[model samples]
Target: MVRPRLTIYVCQESQHGRDPQHEHEDGDSSTGTFFVYHAVYLEELTAAELTEKLAQLFRVPAQQIQQIYKQGPTGIHVLVSDEMIQNFQDESCFVLDTMKAESNDSYHIILK
Candidate 1:
């Protein structure tokens, strides 16, 4: 299935606080529901490249995959579609930062 880019919406939000250009469609924000994340790029791979890769492997729209970068080598927070989750048996398998990412750097992957 070819994932069209038109359906993909990439907007920058201030992780916190209020901004007019946050692009988030939440006008009724009487409550808080946003959480910041820590990220890394040990492999130092671009999120755009990884996103396309995962989209193809997971058989979903590439734009659907979301990644958040932090001040780390390879500890980025990734959020992908449920459909993508079904196809996580690929060569890339990412683990949590709490765990040691030693010699296993080769297996490091992105999960948003």
Candidate 2:
């Protein structure tokens, strides 16, 4: 059977403090710097959904999938099969850093 394709975009909060503009003028200090990751993408799935997808895609146990998320935001983790890595590597995937964006449609989309 043909498997459904998955692509993931990961971003982690920076260890450094929040940006001065986001804290002073915006009056939002809770948000810190977030860095987008370019590699190791997964199919955009939620907690429960991803668990199931990982099981079906990789034929692994539930505990393994849970462990991936527990890895924390410091690094990106994906529980995918060995065969999928090569196949999906060429696809275009991205993680948008929209914290500083003002409007919903402000971001640009480029199709290649």
Candidate 1 per-residue lDDT, tens place, 23-93, comes to 34633244322333222221223456545654564465664543422223564444444444434343432
Residue-level error in angstroms, candidate 1, position 91:
8.8
Model 2 Cα RMSD, Å?
Answer: 14.9
lDDT of 1 at 5: 27
For candidate 2, lDDT tens digit of each residue in 1-112? 5443555444333445866665544133566544534333344334455445434544555544332222215544443334434344444443322221244322221111
Worst 10 residues of 1 by lDDT: 4-13
Query: Runs in model 2 with CA error above 4 Å?
Result: 1-11, 20-30, 36-78, 89-112
- Where model 1 places Cα greater than 4 Å from the true spot, the runs are 1-44, 68-112
Return the top candidate by TM-score: 1
How does candidate 2 fare on TM-score?
0.25
TM-score of 1: 0.26
Q: TM-score for each prediction?
A: 0.26, 0.25
